[model samples]
Target: MNSGLSKRKAFLQSQKNQGHRITFGFAGIADFRSFIGQEYIAGMLKAASDYDLNFINFAGAIKYSFFDDIDFIARYFKTFRFMKKPLIDGLVTWTSSFCELTDVKRVEDTFNSIKPLPMVDIGYLDLPGIPSVRIDNEYSISILMKHLVIDHKYRKFAFIGSETSSPHLERLKCYGQELQKYGIQELENSVFLLKEMNSADIAAAVNKMLSCHDIRDKKEIHCIVTPSDLIASSVIEELDKHGISVPKDVAVTGFNNQYSGVFARSPVTTMNLEYFKRGYAAVELLIDRIMAPKEHFDTLLVPTSLLIRQSCGCFEQSILEAAEAISNSEEPAFSLSTKEDFRPFILEKLRQIFPNLNKNKLLTLADSIFDDIQGQKKESEILRYFQSLLQDLRKEGLFVNSEVQQKLTLLRKTILSFLPDPQKNQMENIFHQLRILASVFIEYDTIAPREDSYLMNTLSQIAINFASAKSGRQIQDVLRYQLGEMGIPGIILSLSENMTSDLGSTSLELILPEPPADIQKKLPFKITDPAFIPKFFFPQGRRYSFMVEILHHEDKYFGFTFLEIGNPNISIYDTVRTLLSNALNTVYLREGRSKKRTMLLTGEELKGILNLSEDDSSEVHNGLKASEITGYLLEHLSEMTDLDKMARELSVSKSHLVRRAKELTGYTIQTMHEKLKIEQAKKLLQVESLKLGEIASRLGFQNQNYFSSVFKKNTGMSPRAWAKRYLH
Candidate 1:
């Protein structure tokens, strides 16, 4: 029975042991506090929890003094040791930069002294029994060099790195080895080791390199290999500030394929080291080692790959070659094929002559050329011919003069014209080919002819003739013939300038008798007012004025027009004056009593009637006519006595005199004082708060009651009400 109990107890103990959990601590979490890091940490925790493991994460920021603080490291290590358990699985230390100041011996010593249960270093340190996961700096640097040499064909190279890191050391070693393989000497002076390079420091370093007499004299420094993409971008910026161009003056290659490199002025060519995968794999390896400490330790080497971009000027050639091959092939393959079989051979040949050609654009051009040649000739024969031509061109070199562009343009036009139904397609394919070629070979410029040329004149004349015809059917006929001659099948005239400024009021106008069916489907603007003009002007503040008259004759409509060009404000005044003068001339030309002229008829007559001389006639005409007319009437008030009776006798409305009086004298005609019996009546009524009956009696009213009622009706109030409100 005791033996049976012992077996049961042992079984229970085994179950408890199986339930045991391992905890992990992550150091320097602050350094890895980005979106990528957060995701990685979450994954790490999930994995640990699944494996019945516990984790204790640590974050020690090395922002300022903490960078060189040995005490901080010692204290953190002590705390970790205290928290560690006898059954602790293992510890992993993750850091971005190297931890050891001196050598691997110092790193090992530091680890042994700490004695944090069982620990591992996962950064840039080689601890004795600890497993590590780090970037394959040597392989990555080699890949970078290959991109620079084989891809970009850059010879003069400079490397930027941090001196206090294992990655830099490994990268330097590999960089030297690769240079030796290419029969190039690795110069010590070319390598720039920055302790903590900021913008100013980076700029200074780049300027020094660029200004160095030896480097400038030897050959143009074509490429710079950097340890970090961020550093490489900074170098590009600095070079630009100094008036030096990237990829043009110097190409740049960087390690660590970062997103920033993609968005930089020149996208950098970088190595993809699989940083996150490396970290995860490192954790898994460290955990396994902890579970079985006596197990044989192993190191994992992650492979690196290249992401080529403008900075290195490498991948463009490959794209060009692929395009060329596709173009030249008889039966063009659609599926992606092997890089070797589909390499950009045409681009490679082109680069032999145009060494500075951008790889991406070159590849695009080659593809276009390939498409152009496809199905046009025997594949084998064309290939042979292309090869021989490329060889000859390379020997002669690409010497593109102005005539070359013109010839290319002519060739493109000819080819487009020969295509099946060229008008229908507009030779879109041919245009694309020409554009690609121009973009690669020519500097930035507009290939289309300017608008002020003979071509534009011909187009304008054709459009004008079509618009001016009387019959809609006639207009269409004229347009079809004219446009067909010019090789234009269809055109929609949206807007046009009728005449040049300085044409004055004699502008040519185009009238569309029958607008296209499509235009009828769209919304229309105001088209009715006879005097309404469509304004046209030059860009540099020259105003051109014109009015269009739509003529309807039979079933056709034509545009009749006149234009005036001058200063806007001046022209408006001049136009009004001209109309008034013409009216006056018409009145003078009339010869009958039925003409029924007034004293205020002529501008000159009105000026004389106002007693103003001829010198002021223009000012009187341009100024308010109503004021001058009122002044003339006031001057002739005695002659025009009995205004109400005179107004009726003159055949003018009473309201007309009131309105004209207000406009000229700034008062109603009733308010005008004529020094008559009404003035004496008003003076007698100006007593303080006088009763209406008393005021009426004093004003010599025949009946006080009738006078009070008349006064009240005229003033819109009783005398008492007015006196109460306004009397002092």
Candidate 2:
């Protein structure tokens, strides 16, 4: 059995063991610099590696491109020679140029010289003795021509050849043979060889072909076929520069069903080579060869199918016909049509634009649009309707861009113009402009369009503000900016010092205003106990003052407004209540609702819910009070006087210490103590030679066990886990 096959089989069998591990090696002529080759091979190898099947590419040792120097080739093989016996379960080659064997004789001679390793050629497998997976290039190209000639009735064809590669050679030959069977002669001059031609060279070639006297006079080329869609696109660009439109003037077809080709202004009708699946299959075949060394080395030729689109003039007639019908309609013009009539038409047009759209999503979008526009008059009235429609379109997996939007807008306008109208033509025009503008707004509003880095920055800013000293102001500022970015209204958070005054008391009472009615009704609000406390005695019928009010600016609702701490006292109860109140008020204001009734919780009420004793002197009830505990913990944490230790020393359970500390200091004892420990650990880790186990042991673990467990639990993972994952 070949070494390559032996290695792959070992790898696969190891994977089945649930604990077995193995690595497969991939060898190619080109260096691992080309994005296409690198990405494809990397993806396959990574998958194999993830499945406990290790994959190593020979890319580091051998250049991806064909080696002209004999020394380079010798070094490449020599690198492999040093690898242990059965180094690769299977050797997978992408292009024939990468391997030592250029022919059958080379295959036998080379493997005979080296230790036996199974080899699988991806495309160029001349040796029937080796396993391979390749596309039926000849058959695929012939099918493409047959479709053009028989179905599309396209004749006077031209061929674009990638003369440097074998696949192109086979395609060109098959194209000529197929055309000949139909009593067609492929003119020698009609064939253009694109060998290392840049954009300018390609453009020149296109110009020459178009300007050819014989071709021009005789109209010899009605349709041109290229070996790849990228080349077809270049041809299209060149022809477009000469004002010769594709499909309309000279129909064009290309191979490789790339999405880029379909998204081209004129979608290209190309062959679906199923590259992803082919890559997947290749790996599977390589794995198979590794496991079964004696199995016959078979060539597996994958089939290709055509994906017809506008580039080949396939859907041109339907689109033109639809456009003409709309232009000729007798209905009064409007900007948007009734959802009932508009959705189906839009769906049809969109299907033409993107053939891959799911039928279910198309129907769902139509339903959503209909629901949105049921009785809405103004376009903005159904703003959510349009938003929902856009979402549905997204679910279809069609790339929505400016161009798609423009086309959709036009289609919507046409449909709306046909629907019944009051002002008729004038209303239609006005609504049309509004719908376009609204679509643009909605497009920009989509979070999907933003890059990850920008979103991360926004989130980081929010987190920083939430943790700031002047958190109330910071929160308001952050919310304001976020709302603006979201195109919502502005908000303000106010702190009223005189809202609550009780000279003898350690707690302050504050009042928060009700949110707008629209916002309030649409949203629910709840005040937590920690942020608000009933501390000041209120005179009968006297309204208590609060610190926050969420507002709306320009008909848009801003986010939660927070109240600043007053001079009287900022307690855990106050912070919790205030945050909860602010959150509720923000939601209400955004929903445009009025405050119904202010709900207040007394110290007794909070104590009952918290299951705390009324005489618990250590209990802190406000965030301000919590800060005192945090400060104490920070100061005494390294003295073996940690919160938990203190709790144990004081003959109290850790839970009791946490509750009492939170009530008295406004911060959780656990939170404060954890921060202190982490700080100390960082300092110790930086200076000490202690192993993680020793460090954990020193941290007061029963052994290193509890210390490492707590360290990781507080942080993210265990101390040893973290060290192994990130320290190095």
- Model 1: how far residue 336 lies from native, Å: 30
Q: Which digits, one per residue and each the tens of the lDDT, describe model 1 over residues 1-728?
A: 46633543354345347643344555432232122343344445554544434444443323222123444443333233222333134566654332532344434543443343455555665655666666666777777777677865777778877776567667877888889888886655688877765777677778778666233322656678887777888988887787667777777777776655755788788887665566556556666565556776656676778777777765434344434543454532233234343335455644654455577755654554444434344333323433343344435765343434444443333333323443315434444444344433332121112111224456456545644554434544664466344433232221111211111111122223333354343312221111112222111122112211122122112222222212111122112222222222223234221222221123444344334444533433223345444443433322323456435433466666656555544555544423221333343344332355544543335566766565566667665565556555
Off by over 4 Å in 2: 1-22, 29-35, 42-52, 57-87, 95-115, 125-129, 213-219, 258-265, 316-728
TM-score of 2: 0.43
Q: How far is candidate 2 from the true structure (C-alpha RMSD, Å)?
A: 25.9
Per-model lDDT: 0.46, 0.51
Q: For all candidates, what are the clash counts?
A: 11, 75
Best by TM-score: 2
TM-score of 1: 0.39
Candidate 2 residue-wise lDDT, 1-728, digit = tens:
77755665566566656533444555555432223343445446445644445444443323322223334444344234322233245556654654443544443444433224666666564754566777888779878888888987877887776677677788888888888889887766788887764677677678778766233322667788888777788888877777778777788888876534654656688888755456556777766766677888668888978788777768633344445655676655434556666666667755765465579756664564454345445443334444655566567755456555555545454445545554345434544454455445544443232211123454344444444424334444555444343222322232221122111011121222324454335222221111122112111122111222222222222222323212111121122223333443444444444422111223443344334455554444432243344444433432344555455434457776677676563546655455456544544454223366544443334566666666777787766555555455
Give me the displacement of residue 517 in model 2, in angstroms: 64
TM-score of every candidate relative to the true structure: 0.39, 0.43
